[model samples]
Target: MGNDGSGAGDGTKATEDAESTQVYRTFRRARDLLLTHREDYAAAREEFAWPEFAEFNWALDWFDRIAAEERNAGRPALWIVEEDGADNRWTFSELSARSNQVANWLRGLGVRRGDRLILMLGNQVELWETILACMKLGAVIIPASTLLAPADLRDRVERGAARHVVVRDADTATFADVAGDYTRIAVGERVPGWESFADARTAEATFSPDGVTRADDELLLYFTSGTTAKPKLVRHTHISYPVGHLSTMYWIGLEPGDVHLNISSPGWAKHAWSNVFAPWNAEATVFLYNYGRFDAAGLMEQMDRCGITSFCAPPTVWRMLIQADLTALRNPPRKVVGAGEPLNPEVIDQVERAWGVTIRDGFGQTETSVQIANTPGQPVKPGSMGRAVPGFTVALVDPVTGQPASEGEICLDLRSRPVGLMTGYAGDDERTEAAFADGYYHTGDVGTIDDDGYITYVGRTDDVFKASDYRISPFELESVLLEHDAVAEAAVVPAPDEIRLSVPKAYVVLADGYQPDAATAESILAFARKNLAPYKRIRRIEFADLPKTISGKIRRVELRGRENTKGDSRATTEFREEDFPSLRG
Candidate 1:
């Protein structure tokens, strides 16, 4: 995306002025309040306001304001570096203009309002440009990570009603089998049938919207992980993600012009939640380090060199980050966060010691933005995921009675109706009704809220097992296992048993000094039994790394499938709870 925001004055002056009067004033106040209470969660939630607007296009309206104003005029909107050392950075001004050019180009190529487009590309400048251009066009975007297989592509094309496709030249082969009436355009070199993206740079830099995007227009389509079934199509509207991510902006505590680098793949909802909308909404520069393989050392160097003010990664990256020397980087970012799942305290502690900053944890799903998080400047409970974001009202309902409880399924009240929520799962009305039943939108995951209003994530509703007729939260067990010297990481799943019906079995990874043998397993089991309730104690242990999804979440479904094949198939280093004689009583 490359042009002149001043050329021909495509966007009417009166419209721009009106946006400045009302919408921008509110944004300024919200942003001000977020910075003022960056450290206080309760204060921020109580005080923050979602910007009120009759009509808005974040790329056209808000981003343009920031560039014209002093706050983000010359600040980098996107900063990129390749492994080979070539790099370029786009200030907010440059990015906004470039997006106009791309928007004009895409319109010329038949991309229009409400038309669905599948965006698949690596971490390149065009990716960001296309995002802004699409937003300006009011088109629905389905973000696809380049890692997707042909099957995944076919699924998206069919399910999402894709009218256009924008992909990298390298990834064109994956689309060979995907049959659709969509326009094909590729970013790098010329593909046989696809139009060249290289033409976008030559297009005029100014673009005027055919009409103002309705705040409720469908903006994004996402395919969920679909563990028990096929991936569900999730839909988000104009204000749903763009404006609703004020919670995410506050959760990460990014300020205007701050360099924020969030490690996530391109296609996932989490990527858009943080990488595209949230950081840019905060007026923060999105810094990316493109690498083939994860290099913890190289990442740290980029952070230091670029002065990344805020950083975020999922538990998978955090797990690997701890394995590397934590203190290798000279300067660590001030604000850091972990998402995609609840992070272990060990990783948090290790990073704190090395960086002098605590790693805040956030929890949300594909259907919503960050609902629960440990906000900046808040008193973070050891394992708690902080508090509900500004626009969300969280309720932990009793699973049996649906009454408010300290620990239960994490649910959002439908009464207040936060904008961040999806328009319900696309094309599955029955499942959608179930998800939003009982005046609440139920998140399948379970969590506990304290008297101070902090919420701690428990395991998923199905993943939390019952052992010896006592409900045992797997996260509680996993937390205890992580405390053991020999334990690296663990996942507890129900293993079928003859007497108990099902028992808690841990799949674990050993720390550096330990091995997967009877002695190591016994020691860890002893440690768990000593630390846990008698009924909640882990009855079986397997010394092996936990299996996870591509996004790094523990695949309990896979483990559950393995247990189904056989009544109880033990791994090479399996140890029964009864193996240790210390608890014969």
Candidate 2:
């Protein structure tokens, strides 16, 4: 009878511990499977499952657990290599201790669970430390770029409902006109009215959570880089980014002790994707090459010197790199990938010829981790973004018919919601509902899947237009334009035509030493005529710089508005393909 009573009394505590163990094991099991089958996509996708956990804190359960291990103690977790040779590296043990101290200090400053904090620092140690600290405290973080002006800062502070703000000392003056009741903490040199982040060093290095962190607790709130309209606030849970980046780790082909360098700015989701969660999750080193201006040769030199194994960059960087001498780098990374925009086939071919490795393409957004990618050991089809990664069910839903189609808007099936997906757009139920309507989470982007399950990117839904009743993907024309030697960058927009209703017009940014004159226009137009079909031929050409959003995406909305206004008269800088005699068929 006594044994039965004792069993009943201890049942709750024993069951709680067992549940915690189950959650940890489940998360680790999924992660290890991806790592084991890093090269075998068929087997991984067939047998992968996202682990569910009721109570989970990634920092405590995963990172701290790994930190305690003897193998990872002295290993470099974060390595920041600067251009001037003043590099910084933090071991797993040091970071784990530092974040504990920061968490304790932050809690003392009235940062409680569920409070939202604004982290607006540069690519410094404090940025990483604060992220870990916030996760430990279970405080939601709103990562803002340092490039934002006073107006944007006010919007984030107000709309984000931020209770605390951490920023660099140099940016403190910009906040003078800003009005907020949040606690202000400054990194770098001490500021007059701001609390010194350096003071956290004196706090104890052992932190105790006030309460258990639920897996669904809000962890991060990201303001999307505005390309079309005002940015949407993307909300992610503790599990969404922390535990959900196993796919990202697999997509990049990361392995333990590998030096992984990803070119991205802080405050962006990709920064956290590679710089923090993905690399750390794989027990790899997060390598950063900081520079004021991009020097492709300089970057390659650094990569060679540091022995960087895995690398990722945006299409913009890849385009600039192909412009330089591709053979400048002696050793290239085996695992190279591109994201942010679709990489042109021309750029991929150039890199493959120069280096032995092929640049794989990955597709995803701030709303989720990588949904589609050309993972390692796969047959990469040119222009295709490869198949859907494990844990995501991608469907191409026809916009008009609202049925599954071979080519349509890319969306994720909500019935089997992926763990990497965001909770919703914070404080915008209307927008959130619209995105998740029709039993799918619409991506606002368009794509087409082939018979082999490879997905090729079409342009954005708003950017795709029709010419002579035939749909035109601007990306297709832009890819062809990029193939030209004189064409540095190009954006194709629809021009109002009398007979065809609309025709394709390209805004060209000439390469160095290439003149933007009649001769250049004739050569470019003649080349386009030979390459493109008659229906997709270039009608108008403008030699002008393209307008880009702050996040570096071309603002086609602005270009479309400009084209609609200019009817017949060509601008002083504009050149029409009709002006070229050889272009006239």
Candidate 3:
């Protein structure tokens, strides 16, 4: 859609303008309701409703409006801290004007509405600018991690049908082998054939949309992390994330002027969830700390210095943070939450003991926003991922009988679809149909609901196995293993056994000052036996690094494969319960 250079006087334009205002107001009302009931989960659930919209552009109708507001205009919208102590901050009005210039610049380069653009950038100001600019231009964004290899880049370009690419200048050589007709744009030092992103600053500061963006118009296409199999393309509409993250904002307890720091890399959905949508939805500043390597102490220093009030991090980061000095920070964030994977109870306990704040757990997938979470001021049941957030109807469905159950596959009832849910798996009708079957959207994860409605996460449906006909959740055994001071991380999988079909086997990573010897394995196994039931005890243990996806999720699928192929011979590093006869009864 091209701007015909027409002035804003036509009847069609007038009607569209009125519709846009109506949708913006509707969105604001829903957001304000959640903010008002921040601590009152029951009231938020009772009063909240997803705003309906026929035509809406979040950047044009919502972000721009907020940017111009007197209260928010001068407030910092984004703050980035470098590892070397360098920092940059952008205000709401500054970003609004900057994104407009970028939008105008991109339009001049032939970028059009509905065109798919591959955005592979690190945590930098240009990343945020391109995001808003693309939204204003109605371009679909395909976010990619900088860690992706050239083959992965080719897959994204081909499968995503990308028309444009924006990446760091150092990564320009990566595209040399990835063949595409897409336009190339670089953010750092100018490349020979690539367009300079710095040129966007010289374009017009004022922006005009070529056409109206419908609420359901495609905005983002995310590729899953491929922890189990090939990555699936997940599609989201203009409203799904921009307006949908109110639940995430509520889950993180974000408020106006709050500085929220979420430890996540760009090119992933979690980045968009916390670093982009959730914090901004509440008019809070999105804070980022860029570092080449993870240093827990350094991160904490920045958090304290930045006056961060709300903090969200993946389970991996939380686990590492516990290994460092927890009391180093003079002031810990008041609001702490964990996602990506379930936080082990031990890690939560350590943080709570040090900071006097519990690490709330939230459950969701790439297909939707926060479905279940421990809201602020709620009694967080240990190991439970709280109740369903407002606007979502969560149920545990029996995979076989297709009926609601107290324990089964965690799913969302499609009868009343939540605005936060994705549209579908793009270009894969078979997968989409299967996911939306049985009147629900299957999360492919298992969980159990207690009488009080808190949901405890079981392992993935594929990861859960049986031993002696008794069901076993790998997460449960892993959690027990993590409780030991010698065990840093552990992944449990079934190994072939002569009797009982199979038995639980653990692949563990040792903590500092712990050796990877039989003595260490024996200590961990003994600790597990004392803590876990007999049926779920660790029958065998091996010291090794856990394989993980780029997003930092454990790949149990690979470990299961390794066990299936291990025909009876065990590695020298593996220790079996039978080898240690002293413990046998």
Candidate 4:
């Protein structure tokens, strides 16, 4: 697929070029439609349609074309802020030229079309450049985190069939024991027998694709976070992510020239969602604040100084931010959002009270972009994750009857597949088929849609349990527990019981200045009793750190296992309500 123009005078060349033009027009029309109705969610949902593309490369067709425009030529596309107070901003034209050079340099190093490359870098300029260069060359990317150990690297290298690797100099040693014939390229300081990424500067600035990029060509491969089980490889086509993040742009209320900051790790899907695709799709600047440790006050000061307009973070960060001084920053971002996990009403209420802006919550997965989100100018119900975004049809199905129900499994209709949905789990036909069963893509999550179409998230299908024949959503109990003063984080799971089959038990993480003594346990238990239903009451409390997956999600499966192995016994750390006299009538 080298840009040799071998078919310069052939009829096939003419047809391919014309088809590419048509694809670009269709994509632009769809993008412009969303921008036109940015605030009108109802109208946007009713009129929006996913654009069809036969052959397209987003970097070549959309981003490059826009970079040449006078309006966006000198506009900043990427802005990186360092913890040491150093910052750098790259304009649209600069990045376009830089990525072209990188693409040319990589091609010289035997990086061919369809070759899988593992990119493990932090928030830096080269990371963004490589993403665009890979897209231009039609090479598939497997983004791994720098935090992965050698064992994890082996899994990615073997399972992903990686042909090339781009990593920092410090992390090069992690792959020393990883057996592979792949090309090693180091980004920082020169390494022995490894290609230096800095050499790209000497390469030619002009770039040409070997051939047209098909819309359905594999582009990104993501490994799931393994919160419940082993990580699954998810494959996305070119159009799935590059063009599908319009929903995310609309969700964040992004506009041209706006600086958008999203707190997420490099390897995760959320990073791609906001850091690259969504911001660029809206012609906005992607802003990053690199820090070793999270400091809420320092982050707010940067946001205030940099004039950030839109912000998105996980619920964990939002929870941490509220614990600090919410009034630190004189100017809060106009658009604030939380995801990765459901945001509790208590956290949302605190932020709204302090900043005068509601924290919108959105629901999605690694397999797709923002499927359901609280869009701009919409009334955010306290805990609802809003209605389905444009181009998605959400349904709730009963687990037992296999029929549509008001409260059951949250799923997506496959009759009209959303462009953001992944192609499939690569090499896992059984899992993919099961996911697409019943003419829907099962999300493995449960939710209830109100009369007005606002969907409130129930716990995961596996996490939701029954106590005394009453359905209990752990999220509901956790949210109530978060409202208490002493509780910082809570994970509720079912404990074995003879009469009720199972009983509600909570593993709590105490807040600052709070103790794990009897006084504190009684107060938290008393608060739960008042706020929760009788059936959902916490029968026992354990003041300890909750176990979580590497991606920061609570691992209730492990906690459930701990309960199952108890065998009619209690741990020494556990404090039962029966042991407290304050709960006795």
**Candidate with more favorable, higher lDDT: 1 or 4:** 4
Evaluate model 1: give its lDDT.
0.83
Tens-digit lDDT track for model 2 on 10-46?
Answer: 6654664565566667778888999999999999999
Q: What TM-score does candidate 1 get on C-alpha atoms?
A: 0.94
Candidate 4 lDDT score at position 119:
97
Regions of candidate 3 where Cα sits further than 4 Å from its true position: 1-6, 10-17
Decreasing lDDT order of the candidates: 3, 4, 2, 1
- TM-scores of the models, in the given order? 0.94, 0.96, 0.98, 0.97
lDDT by residue (112-167, candidate 3, tens digit) is 99999999999999999999999999999999999999999998999999999999
Residue 101, model 1, lDDT: 91
- lDDT of candidates 1 onward, in order: 0.83, 0.89, 0.92, 0.90
Q: Each candidate's root-mean-square deviation in Å? A: 3.0, 3.5, 1.7, 1.9
Worst 10 residues of 4 by lDDT: 1-10
**Which residue pairs show backbone clashes in model 1?**
1-98, 2-98, 39-377
User: Roughly what TM-score does model 2 have, to 2 decimal places?
Assistant: 0.96
Which candidate leads the pack in TM-score? 3
